[model samples]
Target: MENRPLIGITTYLERARWGVWEQSAALLPAAYPALVQAAGGLAVLLPPDDPGRAPSVAARLDGLVVAGGPDIAPDRYGAEPHPRTAATAPERDAWESALIRAAAAARLPLLGVCRGMQLLNVVRGGTLVQHLPEAVGHQGHCPTPGVFTRHPVRPVPGTALAALLPEAELAVPTYHHQAVDRLGSGLRVCARAADGTVEALEGDGPGFLLGVQWHPERDGDLRVVRALVAAAGG
Candidate 1:
């Protein structure tokens, strides 16, 4: 439907050691696509290969959704890799970073989830906490595998994130360890965890750029997706 907004979902590129293995890795949960569809938006998968073509790819889209994936390379934010840092996909870093910048410049509505949130921060001149367990001294973020636990997020009133889920206390699914350390320029913190970790951020200027550390898609929070689509004005 032309009346409906088009949301571009970013894809991850898995690289093998021996040769260049170009393939579509399922970085986002199935719930993401379902949520977008339910929110009256058409979701398109944007791969990390050849991001120079993002302008052309984004030209047809109304919004952009940066999905979660592997840990980002510390170098992108001016830090050294911790021993606990997982495998860093440089190609993914290069492509997604460029894509985020382009999407921001185009004034497209953007939503970043989990690792997507981290990427959004980095793209805006921010940095990450490298290792949550080492820095935060707690493993509460991710308790077990294949299971999600709800956590309280205090959203700053009058923010896009707050307007989407207007509750005194919002319970969201948690699946990330690292979080925003130094906020990016012109971005404001919109939410935080009990441990003082930055949970949500939005663009300071008059555009839709919201990033959440939780997986709203996994928790079936269609309101957030709907708000993003609405901002797209399709």
Candidate 2:
């Protein structure tokens, strides 16, 4: 394995009156870097505004991690915004979509969380359920903020996720209202909630493409990060 795998993490864009803030800004929780570094990988932030530099960005990294953030623009998948939809950034969405496509074409190790997972699905020609509470008839994933809960998920055995986690029953913190409605091509659902919402997906072939609905970073689930780094040949 390489001395240290360089994992490129995608960042969100924030707008300020003075200037355009592009880094992680204070809004996002700061647990990702700690978990990634703890898992023996070097974390590098890739701003969504830097789509023009994705080739160079990909060149310097061994793997990619698409972090959670604002909701993706509904228009990307040929839909209108739902009342429950929060703020949407078109530029960020476009840039991240491009980056996801490039990463997939290059066959790099990728892990998407929350919104990142939705972006990955859309990039692969999938659609999303705009509002969960209105459509799915649940209280929604994150009923409370700044908290974590245990929701049971059944992962398909013999899948990459099952192999990595190995737990027949798993509980993860969820804070998403939007979810994958139609999976992308060449991807298969590896896990799901009791309500039948898609919870996890993996690349059909190989190349280490995995996306989950939960915030593994928040829970210090280093196995996800480690699995990506290992797939990167670290």
Candidate 3:
């Protein structure tokens, strides 16, 4: 087998029904691993569990992808809950948060999508505008469940995302009800929507550490994923 870089992707724990079995399952959208493999990396699904194991997991992987999912518990970031926020997944929150820390400590390349991006920010002393509709004057960020709304995002002139997406602007697949309000420590905004909502952020770390509020996997855009895979190296 070729020495493809191993990419660990976070998953969701949810009550699900499938083929005569209905129970809480660790699930991930097929698009995630599919995109990872397409980018020449081996995909591994990581169910949220004992956070103490994060360092072990991080040490074994070449990169990490914090997949998108439910709203993080506001308490994790010392904020009050929003009426529209979904029920929290404390296990997933703790697990992914620990993974983020471990990955940073190991200087592993990491990519965070949607909720993953928000989690990355929160883990670094940042805050989110829990309900973006009121903050941005529209529900365009997440127009409907199970479907993605489209919008244009521009990459900052000298950022990694800009190099990957050299185009002046990109129409991205977006779905979220929250956004980074205060910049996180050691993080910088790398992309933005026309409405001034943050679209991407990058960390000041040893290797590639990028986060996108948009869904590149769903859109099948390999630029970002390929960049991560290449950074991880085979």
Q: lDDT score, residue 115, model 2? A: 88
lDDT of 1 by residue, 10-105 (tens): 876663243576554535556877888889888878777677877776677899898887899998889998887774667778877887888877
lDDT of 1: 0.82
Each candidate's TM vs. the true structure? 0.90, 0.90, 0.97
Tell me the deviation in Å of residue 98 in model 1: 1.0
Q: For each predicted model, how many residue pairs clash, with residues at least 3 apart or on different chains?
A: 0, 0, 0
* Candidate-wise lDDT, in order: 0.82, 0.81, 0.92
**Residue 135 of model 2: what lDDT?**
64
113-179 in candidate 2: lDDT tens per residue? Answer: 9888899999999999988777678765766765656687889888989999898878887888789
Cα lDDT tens digits, model 3, 1-234, are: 579999999999989999999999999999999999999999999999799999999999999999999898888788899998884688999999999999999889999999999999999999998899999898888889888989999999988778889988989999998999998899999999999999999986557999999999988689899999998883
Best-performing candidate as measured by TM-score:
3
| Candidate 2 lDDT (Cα, 0 to 1) | 0.81
Superior by lDDT: candidate 2 or candidate 3: 3
Please list the Cα RMSD from the true structure of every candidate, rounded to 1 decimal place.
Answer: 3.4, 3.1, 1.1
Better of 1 and 3 by TM-score: 3
